[model samples]
Target chain A: MKEFLVISGKGGTGKTSITAGFAALAGDIVLADCDVDAANLHMLLEPVTYHTEEFIGSRKATIDPTHCSNCRLCQESCRFNAITSTEIACTVNPLSCEGCGVCSFVCPKGAITMHDHVSGHWFLSDTRYGPLVHARLGIAEENSGKLVAKVREQAQRIAQEKDVEYILVDGPPGTGCPVISSISGVDLALIVTEPTIAGLHDLERVRQLAGHFDVPVMVCINKYDLDEAYTRKIELYCQKQQIELAGRIPFDRNVVSALVRGIPAVAYAAPSTSENSAAKAIGDVWQAVRNRLLA
Target chain B: MLITIASGKGGTGKTTVAVNLALTLKELLPVVLLDCDVEEPNVHLFLQPVVNESEKVMTTVPKIDGNKCDGCGKCSEFCAFNAIAIVKGKPITFPELCHSCRGCTLVCPTGAITETPRQIGLVEKGTWSVIKTAKGTLKIGSPLAPMVVDAVRNTAPLHHGDQAVIIDASPGTSCAVVAAAKDTDFCLLVTEPTPFGLNDLTLAVELAKKLGLPHGVVINRAGLGDHSVYDYCHEADIPILMEIPFDTKYAACYARGGRLVEEFPDLSDRFLKLWDVIQHHAKRHQREEPKT
Candidate 1:
């Protein structure tokens, strides 16, 4: 199967908006939302989860007060400074803990025990587009990278079972663990960037990340007209890098309206002149990703 | 004095404020604006530092010796981060999942698990003469940002009791933020006044409290949302240092790689005073600590 992943180096770069549009155009494909930290693609997909799984992340060391010993050794051993002693009871701040387990080992009384923490939930769902796999995490919870891997696994299985020709994935922003998991073994990465300096800056960063994994990358400039001069600069950068400059999307209010309406450009405003720019942009990106990845 | 500009939510303009502040503050004091947001380091584009120096940031990971293995699976059981997993009589290493804790090494009976250093990223330091901002860039695809931030901060030229050091941190209250905020004198959390901003700001504030750092807010896009954040600040007795208006022209300048304070250097007086208020809070908090 041919796979195409859309990603932004940072948040709010129109990755989902363009991904959902491609989902409308894609046929016989399994959709995956790999942005497990803030998987808002499901908000647009509205997928009904057919299967769910629990993902246990790192564990925190808890001090048992009933152990009848208050040795401050555990407190001192923790480099994270998670454990603090007061007049009454010793406390381990969950937020401060890195789950290093150094405190648990140092406790002579064995009072400090590590307990599994529920990081988040992964789901295999059916959306209008096709079988969709996604996940959601608790606030300030770790282990999003694992959750993203699970989502991709389910999507690949669904695609194989149905003999689908395509597997569309919406990758997370940034070069974090989740992005690493998403980009690994991917056929091609469609990097959605903006025209601003920050956007171009992050584009270079994410491009470097994709380069490490040997993944083919294509760029789509969102709101290119917002800064035409910067847009030109970005074009020059892409040319210098020898990476394809897939498409340029002009600033349009309809993109926001389409998002609020909970439908993609192809579905919500198909044949509408307002979405012509974005529609062309999506098509160009899809074609570039396919040309570079598919045999 | 190292001031870290941080926000809990993504894209609340942490880099914009950091770059501009570094640009503006350089005139008042020698500044080093280290971009601790390794996941998406963007300050390099704005400042375009020359990268006079670069260094690898290494973190320790456990390496198990098969000949010395005891098949106890104790290392796996002892690992809190689940970075080590015993599958089919062999321990698998997940480097990205690893937190660089030496617990597995300490617990190995035969000393099979030993600490090994892996280069996760690089710290690039240079001077931007245009904005007069001395900056550091944390390389991408590297999970260890705090390492770069530490390297940048600990490098020579630290103007103790003199020049101020400002770090632009990654979004969210994660390990990276903790690393950046660990030794800072005070923090300035730039946030919006929206519900998402308020929720994440509360988390960041809790982080500040837990870290024992005095902090105030710079509410950007102040009029866009309700002042519940302001109300919360009042109730918590925290100071609102400054409120940047929702100006598209400012956003345009930011988009064009233009410095807001450069166009209008008068804004530096207000920012510096904001830092003064933070200093005031630090003095007050230090005074409140009981005599040891």
Candidate 2:
């Protein structure tokens, strides 16, 4: 199956909306929302969960006060500064811990032990369009990249079992761990960007990341009419980079209106008059992406 | 006071709020603006700071000495990240997977492992119109954003007791956001009015609460969506500090890299007022806190 990912290096650039629009158009494709930290695609698809799994992200070092050895070794050896030692005991800050086992290894008293922390939950659900694999990372939790990988693995498994032709993934913003995990091993990465300096700057960064991973990339400029000059600049950059420019979606109020109604633009827009709407532009983008995938 | 501009969802004007607020606060006091969104930092794009110093952010990965050692597999067994594996009595390392914890080096029985610095990103120190600015830029494929963020946060000048440190955090309530918002005097959670925005804003608020930060909301694109966000803030008892309505003109100006406070003189006064409200809320929050 072809793995298709919709991502924006910058957040709130209509990545999920566009991904949901593709879901509305491409029936029965395996869907994965890899933005575990702040997943929003599920709001549009309204998936009914069929399977759920607890995500044990990483191990955090904990000290047993009963052992009574406050040698301060764990506190000093922890590179993350997650441990704070008082005269009576040492405590680990869950938010600060990177889950590296150095503290446990360095403890002379063997008081520190590494325990697996359940950071989040992933779900396999049936949406109106297909089976969706999504997750919710715990508040202020670490290892979002690992959770993203879990979501993609489950989505790929479901796709393989059902013999689906495509797996559409809604990726997170920023060129960070989660975005890297989402784009890794994907067949095509459609970067959704906007017409702004921030958009262009972040697009360049994420595009470089995709290139670093040797992933084929296509560009879709959302809110292309917001700044015509920046749009032209982006088009020129894409041309210079030899990257394919898939489609340009104009600034459309219907996009937000559909979002406010908790539905995909393709589903909410009137079919008869959607020729010039954001929904239509998304359909064109989907077609372009599909053609590229098949090619 | 250290104030962080953050959002659960991206593109909700974290950088916009941070830059404008820094500019506004600079008029009253010394301000230091930190772009802690290392993954896709955009405050530099908005402020266009002249970088005075650029320092490489490094993480150490274990380098195994093959000639001096027998592969005991202890390092592999002790590694939490599974970055090292012993195959046929030879230990192999994956640098990308390594967390640079130095556990493997300590666990090696043969004393054949040493640390090597790997460049993950860079932290740039600069000045933007009297605002001391710093930003971190993670390498293209690097995933160690929190380390870069920490470096940027550390780059702030010491002895600025009266200056306001404004941190522009990346979206999502994950480790990176926490690294930016943690220990800040206050957090400004920016959001829109849509259901998606509300859903993510709730998570962001939970993060702020968990961090014990006094937070207020800044509603961007106020008229674009529904009232669910307002209801959420009201139900949660969180104050709405500012609202920038959904206007094409404002968006167009922002798209062209124009500061809202500069292009629209009225917004300057609004941001100034917003700062006063934040200071008051922070003070009241401190007063209401129970003794530790």
Candidate 3:
């Protein structure tokens, strides 16, 4: 099955909205919300989870008070400054620790030990489109990249088992570890960006990142009418980079109202209107993306 | 006071709030605006700071010496990031995957592994009008965002005890956000009124609570969705510091790379009021904390 990833280097550029639209258009597909830290795709798809598992992405160092010596060695050797010493005892701050195990290794009294931390939870769910694999990392948790990789792996496994046609991944924002994990090894990376200076700047960054990983990238300008000049600039940039322009979607209040109603724009069955302009644009974009993927 | 502007979800106006607040406060105080959203920083676009100096941000990765190596494979075993592998009885290092934890260098029994500096990004310093500005930009493929964030924070100009330092943090509640929000006096979490906004705002609120930082909320695009975000904040006892109405003019100004305070001078007073509220909260938090 071909895996298509929807990513935006900058946040709040409608990546999840476009991904949800693709899920509605693609028939036989498994959806994966790889934005583990802030997974919003499940909100639109409304998945019913069948299986759930705790994800222990890393370990945290904890102080065992039973063998307390208050030597302060662990506090000194820790690069993260996670260990704190007081008049009473020494303790480890889990938020500051990166689980490098340096404090545990340097503890002369053997008071520090590394324990597995359940940083997040992943689920295998059934959505209206197909099987969905998604996860939620705990608040203030690290290791989001690891959690994203796990979600992608589970989605691919379900796609192979069910003989699905595609795996549409809604990626996290930014060019950080989580975004890298989501876009790496994907068949095509479709970037959803707005027509703005920040959007253009971030598009270049994410496009360069995709090129580094040797993945083909396509661009979709969301809210293109907000600035016609900037939209033209984006078009020129895509042409210069030899990247395909999937489609341009105008800003629409119907899209926001559709999200408020907890559904994709394409799936919005308004009584008065059959299809919104944004949904129609997304339909065309999906057709072009499908043709490219098949080729 | 070091005030960090953050949001759990992307595109929620963290940069807008931060840039406006810094510009407004700079009229009354020396302000330093540090953009810690290293991976995809947008503050520079609005501020239009003319960069005066830039420094490369580097991280230390393991450099294995083949001649001194006995091929124990211990370095690979200790690497948590899977950056090292024992191939053909020799250790091969992948610098991009390395977290720069120095675990392999400490655990190498053969003493063949050494640390070397690898450039990950750049931290730039400049000024936009009266406000001193700094931003971090990660090299396109690098995954070590927190390292660049730290570099940006470290390179910021030193502020006096009374000056304001506003940081625009990256989206999401991960290590990058932690690096930006650490040791800040207050955090202004910007969000919209949508369900996605509320869901992510909840996580961001939890992060602020975990870090023991005093925080308030600034709702952007106020009329776009329901009142669930305000209700969640009310139930959670999180103060709604300010609200900016959803306006197409604001979107157009942002699209044109114009500052909010510049386009709408009235916003200056609102941002100044935001500073007062943040100070009030910070003072209240200080009074509640016990002296060591």
**Per-prediction TM-score, chain A only?**
0.93, 0.97, 0.97
Residue-level lDDT of model 2, residues B27-115, one tens digit each, is: 78999999999999888777899999999999999999999669889989988887899999998998877888898888888899999
Candidates in order: C-alpha RMSD to true structure: 5.0, 1.3, 1.7
Q: Give the clash total for candidate 1.
A: 0
Q: DockQ numbers for every candidate?
A: 0.33, 0.86, 0.76
Work out the TM-score per prediction: 0.78, 0.98, 0.97
Clashing pairs in 1: none
Task: Give me the iRMSD of candidate 2, please.
Answer: 0.9
Please identify which of the two predictions, 1 or 2, would achieve the higher lDDT against the true structure.
2
The per-candidate count of clashes, in order, stands at 0, 1, 1
> Among all windows of ten consecutive residues in candidate 1 chain A, which has the lowest summed lDDT?
A267-276
Off by over 4 Å in 3: A65-71, A87-89, A271-276, B156-160, B290-292
Superposed on the true chain A, the predicted chain A of model 2 yields a TM-score of 0.97
Question: What digit string (tens of lDDT, one per residue) describes model 1 on residues A1-295?
Answer: 8778998787567788889888887767889988776565776677787788887766887988887277788777776667898766578988667777888887888888888878778888888988888886555555566777788888888889899988899987778767888998888888898888889878888899899889988898987877888899999999999988778887665665565556775566644565446666676766666667664
> Per-residue lDDT of A155-199 in model 3, one digit per residue for the tens?
989989989889999999999899988888999999999999999
Minimum summed lDDT over a 10-residue window in model 1 chain B is located at B130-139
TM-score for chain B of each model, two decimals? 0.86, 0.97, 0.96
Per-model lDDT = 0.75, 0.90, 0.90
